[model samples]
Target chain A: MTFFYISAAVALISSVLAISRSNAVHALLYAIVSLLSVALIFFMLGAPFAAALEVVIYAGAIMVLFVFVIMMISSGPGSTQQERRWMNFRLWIGPSVLSAVLIIELFAVISPPREPMSAKPVIESKQVGIALMGPYMLGVELSSLLLTAGLVGAYHLGKRKDDAAQTEDVTIHD
Target chain B: MTSVPAEYGLILAALLFAIGLAGVLARRNIIFILLSIEIMLNAAGLAFISAGSKWGQADGQVMFIFILVMAAAEVSVGLAIVLQLFHRIRTVNSDEANTMRG
Candidate 1:
């Protein structure tokens, strides 16, 4: 429980920091920390597989992708200065108040007393694998299709016009 | 061993989601907007995991995996679009991309 609270706090704080940073790289670093701490919370909640995926996919792969893009874009000091200028206190106030109202409503809705239940056994990755391959197989297949489409779309969108023209000669049959 | 109350986990998720919302609303940069959206997606995943844990079921984790898959696809395509947008405008500012408004 202690670990859960600690990590939860860490996640929240880092997430806040991640969003508020002027530098994109700095924000990505904080977001990684926030993700890692969320993984810890998942482990504490007895979803070990989810925790592992959170760390590996969320923190490692996804964040590395963001970092690579940031590096590729090479947003310089001028961009950071622009970000700082854009992130003025007046811009923050309205959203912060709105979110605060949202949080209050959420808390009110979920804070009602409920029956306490006994703790369940940990869910192993093996069961998750079986579940995925069994009942959720269709979802898995669909997601794969979605991923493939995303890959193709990203390739098309990111391709340079000249590069596409150059490759057109190679795809003359198509 | 004692487990944290399910409500606490849920509250944490709510807080994170709200923070992400604020970021999305407040930030003008397209990259930050995407990052904020990631945070919001993550908060939803956390809520699912917490609810699944409460019920002692594997379904929550399954949903999380699906969410993960979607987020991956979204990020890849989103970043690609961002890259193309940057190439065109040379600016990451969302406000400057007003050419599509009219």
Candidate 2:
């Protein structure tokens, strides 16, 4: 119970910090921490498989993609001072107050007495696989199709018309 | 198992959702807005998982798997658009991209 609370609190705090950071890379780092802790929360909640997927997919793969884009788009190392100047301490106040209201609301929600459920059967990966393959097969296939389409679209959109010219220019400069 | 209540999970999910909302409403960066949307989607998934746990069903996890895939697709498309927008206007700030304005 304490561990669950700790993980949830950590997830909330890091997520707040993640969104508030002026530097995109710094925000991504904190977002990774937030996702990792959310995975821990999932594990504690009895969905170990989901937790693992959360860590592997959300924290690992997706965040890596975000970092790659951040690196590609950043103008280089010369903007550190400018980024530092933009990181205002006062920017924390809005998120802090909103999160505090949420924490208060959480306490209110949890305080209400309700009928406790009978213990739930642990959901393992095998069961998830069966469920996915059985009733949700169509969704699974569609999601794969969506991913493929997204990949092609992203590739096409991200390709620069001047890519060859830019490379040649760089080589000449070198 | 420590036998945590489903309501606790719901409360946590709500908190997360609210935080994500705050981020989306407050941040001007397109990437941050997208990240905030991801957080909101995760919150919804958490709520589904919590409800599934409460009812002792696998449907919630199944739904979450779909949500995960959708989020991945959304991010790829969104970032691609972001990249193109940056190439065009040389900025990722959402407010600066007003070419579509009437």
Candidate 3:
């Protein structure tokens, strides 16, 4: 429970920073922290292998790309017209009401009678590797192909970083 | 008796999901939107782990690893597209990229 609370707190702070901050680099860092906290939460839930993969894959590789984008692009909200704003009351009212109802539902579940059955879980790093390459090997290969396609797509997209020169590329139909 | 109930995990995941949704709805930055999407994904993963505990199986944990791999792919592809869009349009803001929207 201590780990849970700690992860909750960190997640809250990091997520807030990740969204609210004006600086792109700062926001990316907050994203990293947010991901790591959730990874820790996974660990506390007896998913050590998943937790490590989360850190290694998400916090390590994906966030690195996010940070690289922020580095390449300055923190400015580029070419934004002054006609619109991010705030609108319609958006808040609906979600807020839903959240209130959800909170009430959560309170109802606060004190339940659970037998708290935890198994001796035999999940090791090796077991996962074997499972991936075993009969479930199809899943592993499919995902690897997906990941490779993603990398190729990313490379193709980012290779055209003519930032200032390509300003005429996006034609607004409005 | 334990200090915190086992179902606390579910509630926490719900909270994270809400936060992520809020981030998604309220933020206009593309990168922030992507990050918010990640928070939502993380919330889902946490819920799976909590459910795994309830069921006494490692399936949820295994599922989470796959989710992690997918998220990495998503982020890389997404941010790369964002980067490229910014380069072409010179803006990373999503509200302005409505050229395709009818």
Candidate 4:
């Protein structure tokens, strides 16, 4: 439990710094620490499977590509562009309020149970594999197809550049 | 010693998720934005695992694996596009990339 609290504190601090920091690389490094801390929390909670996935996928794979993209393009913030492009608009206000409500609802749901920790050992990936690939295979397949399409579209969009002035390397879809 | 319960982790998860949202909202750097989204995803994953363990279910673990796979796909393809966008635009700032305005 102490470990969980420590991990939580670390994750919180890093995440806050991840946004507040001006250096883009430093921000990414902070994000990585936050991710690892969350992964540690998963481990302490007895979900070793989620813990492993957290470390491998979020900390390892996704972050590697992020660093790679940063290197290919540039490091740190580009010119002090102060274009106040609706950074404080109503577009996000409504969603944020709704999210806050959802968080409160989650708190209500989780606060009641004070049962002792279960004695069952940690669940492994094999159990998860059976659940996802056996009973829940269809949804997973559709998501995979969706990912493939996204990759192809991104490739197509990114392939037509032969110039040096082109700066952005990834264009997210709407 | 009084230890924090798993429910406290939910609150922590909510806070972390919000921070990620702020990162995605406030930052203009593309790499930072991607990192923010990663934070958001991991936060949700943490909530899932913690809740699942508290409730005694393996479904959460299973969901996390898929989430991991999706994260891998996202970062790979996302970075590839970022690389290409950088190649064509020479800038990674979202505010600057206005090549496709409709």
Candidate 5:
């Protein structure tokens, strides 16, 4: 229970930090921490398979892609300093106020039940697979198709138009 | 083992979702915007898992797997578009993408 509270705090603080950063890479690092903490929360909730997937997919694979893009687009040190200079204190007021309101709303609404914890069966990965394959098979197939389409679309959109050939032989400047 | 209340997990998930919303509404960089969307997706996944726990079922985890696949597809397509935008305009700021503006 204490571990759950600790991870939840970590997730909240890190997510706050992530959204507030001006540097994309810095924000991404904090987002990874936030995801890992959420994975811990999943573990505490007795969903170990979900926890592992959260860590592997969110914190690991997706974040690496983000880092790759950030590096690909970064201008240089001059841009780093420019990003820091662009971080005006006034810009944070909106998000901070919104977050505060949400925090207050959550605390006001959630009243824990007095009943003590009861023994629950551990959910194994095998059970998750069985359930997925049984009742949710359509969802699984659709997801695979969606992933394939996304891959093809990404490839098509990302290809450079100029790579093939120039339409005109030379530019005609009047 | 001292088990925590389900409300605690729900509260945390709600807070995370709110933070993600704030990020989406406030952040100007497209990458940050996409990242905020990912945060929100994860928050939803958390809620589902917590709800499943409350009911003592694996349905929540199953839903999370679907969410995971959808998120992956979204990121791939989104980053591809981001890459294309960068190549076209040389900027990643969302506000600068006004070519379609009338």
Candidate 6:
């Protein structure tokens, strides 16, 4: 229980920091910390399989993709300077207050005493796999289809045009 | 035996989601916006896992796996579009990308 509270707090604080950072790399690093802490929470919740996937896929693969894009764009120091200017108190204060209110409301709604459920067995990876293959087979197949389409779309959208052609296309589009 | 109540797990998820929502509403840079969306998606996954744990069912974990798949596809295609947008506009400020705001 102590570990769960600690990790949950870590996740919340890091997520807040992740979004508020002016530098993209700094924000990405915080996001990674936030993700890892969430994974810890998942582990404590008796969903070890979900926790592992949260680490392997969410923290590893997805974040690396964001890092690669940030690297490729290579926003100079000037960009961070601009970001700093844009991320002022005026811009963030409203959202922060609104979110705080929402959270408080959620806490109120969720904190009411309720009957505790009987203890059940932990969900293992094997059970998850069986569930996926059995009743959720259609979802798995559809996700694969979505992945294929995303791959093709990304490739098409990301491909570079010839330099001269690009200039001409930009002129026409603008 | 799981020690923590399901309500606590849910509260944590709600907190994360709120933070993500604030990020999405506040950030101006497109990358940060996308990152905020990722955080929101993650919070949703956390909620599912917690609910699954409550019932001792594998379904929550299965749903999280699907959420993982959806997030991966979203980031891949989203970044591709971001790259294209940066190439065209030379800037990642969402406010600046309002050329199509007819």
- Backbone clash count, each prediction separately: 0, 0, 0, 19, 0, 0
Per-residue lDDT of candidate 4, residues B1-95 (tens digit) = 24346688788989989998998999898877888888888888878787777776778777776677677667667777777667656678989
TM-score of 4: 0.74
Error of 3 at A15 (Å): 2.1
Candidate 3 residue spans exceeding 4 A from truth: A75-122, A161-174, B1-6
True contacts kept of 4: 0.64
Among all windows of ten consecutive residues in candidate 5 chain A, which has the lowest summed lDDT? A165-174
Pick by lDDT: 3 or 6, better one: 6
- Predicted structure with the largest lDDT when compared to the true one: 6
Candidate 1 per-residue lDDT, tens place, A1-174, comes to 655666777778888988998878668867877887787778767788998899899988888879778767866768777657656776455335434443443344236672222255678898889889999999999999999999999999988897754565345423
User: Which scores greater on lDDT, model 2 or model 3?
Assistant: 2
Better of 4 and 5 by lDDT: 5
Name every residue pair that clashes in candidate 2: none
Q: Which number leads on TM-score?
A: 6
Model 5, residue A120: C-alpha shift (Å): 3.5
- CA error at residue A157 for candidate 3, angstroms: 1.9
Cα-based lDDT for every prediction: 0.81, 0.77, 0.69, 0.69, 0.80, 0.82
Docking class of 3: acceptable
Ranking by lDDT: 6, 1, 5, 2, 3, 4
Off-target runs (Cα >4 Å) in candidate 1 are: A75-118, A163-174
What DockQ was computed for model 1? 0.40
Better of 1 and 6 by DockQ: 6
CA-only RMSD, every prediction: 9.4, 7.8, 9.3, 10.6, 7.7, 8.1
Q: What share of the true interface contacts does each candidate keep?
A: 0.70, 0.48, 0.58, 0.64, 0.70, 0.77
Standalone chain B TM-score for every prediction: 0.96, 0.94, 0.90, 0.91, 0.95, 0.95
The candidates, ranked best first by DockQ, are 6, 5, 1, 3, 4, 2
DockQ, every prediction: 0.40, 0.36, 0.40, 0.39, 0.46, 0.48
> What is candidate 3's lDDT per residue for B1-102, written digit by digit as tens?
233344887887898888889988998889889888988888888888777766656667767767777888888889888876776667888987766525
